[model samples]
Target: MPAALHPDFLRLPVAHRAWHDRAAGRPENSRAAIRAAVAAGYAIEIDLQPSAENRPMVFHDYDLKRLTGRPGKINAFTADELAATRLIDAEDGIPSFAEVLEIVAGRVPLLVEIKDQDGAMGPDTRGFEAEVAAALGTYAGPLAVMSFNPHAVAAFHAARPDIAVGLTTSSYRPTDWVFLPAAACDALREIADYDRVGASFISHEHDDLARPRVAELKAAGAGILCWTIRSTEAEAAARMVAHNVTFEGYRALIPG
Candidate 1:
């Protein structure tokens, strides 16, 4: 039988990018943010971008400019260089997935989103999923991996079938996805690959949670989670559809 999403993931508010706060010295995916989220009693969500050596680095952007104040693509650097690169105006440098895993230490659940390696979500996505699985081997935690690219999710499930895997979905509106072709967006928007990929859940775009297909997935018993929710009101509304929320920018009350 396919693995299922763990029940603990649905019970707590997840800290988007690990409860990041730049002014507080906790940049997204930084060790400080991971520590802060663990301290706050919330499940943590993080993104992994591949470094030159295919090492999974805890980061969000494909480029290093926004986060590191540098002017190159992140994968241009090896794992060592990426690990040494510091986040803009923050004391912490980019951390490896293994380092972040050590910090969390299974204290709280972790939700990881693998940034799409295949520029257009194509099959050329390298074996980064294999690298990620190797790094996660020692982590005994309540955690799951997901990606906007269904191909990556399928690859990850193949790499570690014992672990629950999922998709990070969106409406894929053309205006918002100018980089992806309309056909690709239309195909992804339907989330038709969820079953074939062996996905157990989805962390969907919060504003798009009301989409009919999202409701259909919910009805079918997929564990529903939503992302980047920023306020109490939005959290309340999302709760009507999502089993749990991955939030940022504000404190979300833990549901009773």
Candidate 2:
């Protein structure tokens, strides 16, 4: 599939895990959370993983115990099996990727992060790339795919160069590469490589917000996005310091 023309993701502070409220509704990647984000007029970022039957669903953890109280890996159960499992404390249930895209249709853009192998890209990781690409074919709104694994992003780009891809890294490491403790040289090298390979944006942890290295990347025209900010103060700080901010559980912090 060709990459679709994406809108400017820099416009709004994206909600990293949707607007999740465990007590009032489901948490991240649940249907309720995605809906809440749409209602709040914020874009959302979500993780995509497949079920045992090769169905794509909105979820984060590899195991089901944390969210569903089920004792197994997400890939161990079919979509039907997952649907039968109750999501902890929410009135709504786990949602398939198709369902999520349908509900949020044309409301807000989604930054779909493919959780790569142990936070790095390697062959041992499951083939989430193919499933994600397949599911995305059904989507009709603005969307971008991001991953900490360059290989994952590379694979997705290879499959669909038209879709905007964001390469995620942490300041704890260098931005040039996707691995931990990435060297500065590696960051520069990778930025060039990603550009040559067609990545549209770059996302890094907030800890790297004020670093000179971040400014360097931004100067080079890599669309910058900072993540996992959980407080209003942090969001404010990010807005003052970064190009785009991704906050988890703090949609209310964004001014209407």
Candidate 3:
């Protein structure tokens, strides 16, 4: 793996969300947030979703009520509609994935979580993944693609093996959240299966890092990345325990 995509994420602590300080101009998934992360010397990880017209945009939620105060589904709005919507974090404009890429350039590696809910891909998504790949073609920095939907990750990896792919899970979802289901195995078998799927890393909620399955992942040549860590001290503690990298709400951890 390239230094940028190294299995060991310990080199730079990742911020889960972009440095979106509502008071400062940093809005999650906005170009401003990406710029802030670059200025702070921290790598960035962001979420991608297709707008109504199938254009790729930087956003994390399926609904727009929280960020935009506009009650509607993200996929229900066209790019122009989304563009017209302002981030509730002080009138910051929502940014396109391309715009964010331009701002960050190669300043820091990026981990993109592609939205593949319900198997929506290709033309159904206006070829969002292909567009993302095209945008990334202009970037020289390290890049990794991830998804909670295995099919999405598989599709991206099959198309572009050059970029590493990670599989993410959360404790809340009983079905897909757990990599290995009881039918597969009651124990650590799920982690092993995910590794078999060519996943370079396992990104899970911070709490999941404590499950006994983590050791199984380590043994399978996979790395551990915990998500949404908000505090520096919590990050330190997680690193000491099981996580090799952390996404703490968009702030990259700069080593002292």
Candidate 4:
């Protein structure tokens, strides 16, 4: 049998990259945004990027140019060095996964996505799974880990069997992902890796929730989670198929 997502995770809206509001000075994945998500009583979603030391950092991009305005790969820096670097708008530093756990302190459920280190989403996982398992050893929280790469998810599940694992699915629209070759997208579109990776859930692209494969997964008892919802209409649409939503940009409604 596949692992399962805990019930609490489906009860509330998950803040995508935390409750980020750059105009309000809480940039995505910043400590301030995560804190705000906790205070607002929403589940928090974050991404993990490996650092120079192979430690997991709470970051979205492999490169620092966009978020930090610095011109190097995030992995080029050690944990301390990355933490010292500030996000452009908020002046908050890039925090490690360990630091994020401290900030969240298990206040709400966490949804963590492990960024693919190798561009191919291939089998070379860089031991990030084991590294994250080590970091999460002491965190007694309601959380789950997922990745776009099946290999990474499988690796993580092996190392941390107690934690739930899932796949971050996509519609595999070619224009949307220029870097991913069309063949790769086509292969991933079918979600053939779902069972192989022991994934019990999938966080799929919001616009593609109506995909037949998504419904099939749900019927097979897989949890259905949706991503990057930014409007109430979209939220309602996603809720039609999703157990819950990972949202950003606007406040999401919690069910009564």
Q: Estimate each model's TM-score.
A: 0.98, 0.85, 0.82, 0.97
Instruction: State the lDDT at 151 in candidate 3.
Output: 59
Q: Give lDDT tens digits, candidate 2, residues 174-229.
A: 44454444454355334444555467677877776777756776786667888888
Q: After superposition, how far is residue 102 of candidate 1 from its true place, in Å?
A: 0.6
- Model 3: residue 83 alpha-carbon error in angstroms: 1.9
Order of models, best TM-score first: 1, 4, 2, 3
User: Scored by CA lDDT, what does every candidate get?
Assistant: 0.91, 0.74, 0.68, 0.92
What's the residue-level lDDT of 196 in candidate 2?
51
TM-score of 4: 0.97
Q: What is the lDDT of candidate 4?
A: 0.92
Which candidate has the top score in lDDT?
4
Model 3 C-alpha lDDT per residue in residues 74-180, reported as the tens digit of each score: 98998888888998765566788887777878677777898865542212434566666766765766667787666566666766778788877555443643534
Which lDDT value does model 3 have at 235?
Answer: 73
Over the stretch 206-240, how does candidate 1's per-residue lDDT look in tens digits? 99998999999999999999987999999999999
Give lDDT tens digits, candidate 4, residues 1-256. 7667888789989999999999989999999999999999999999999999999999999899999999999989999999999997886699999989998998899999999977888889889999999999779888999999999999999998888999999998999879988999999999999999889899999999999999999999899999889999999888999999999988987778
Q: In candidate 1, list every pair of residues with a backbone clash.
A: none
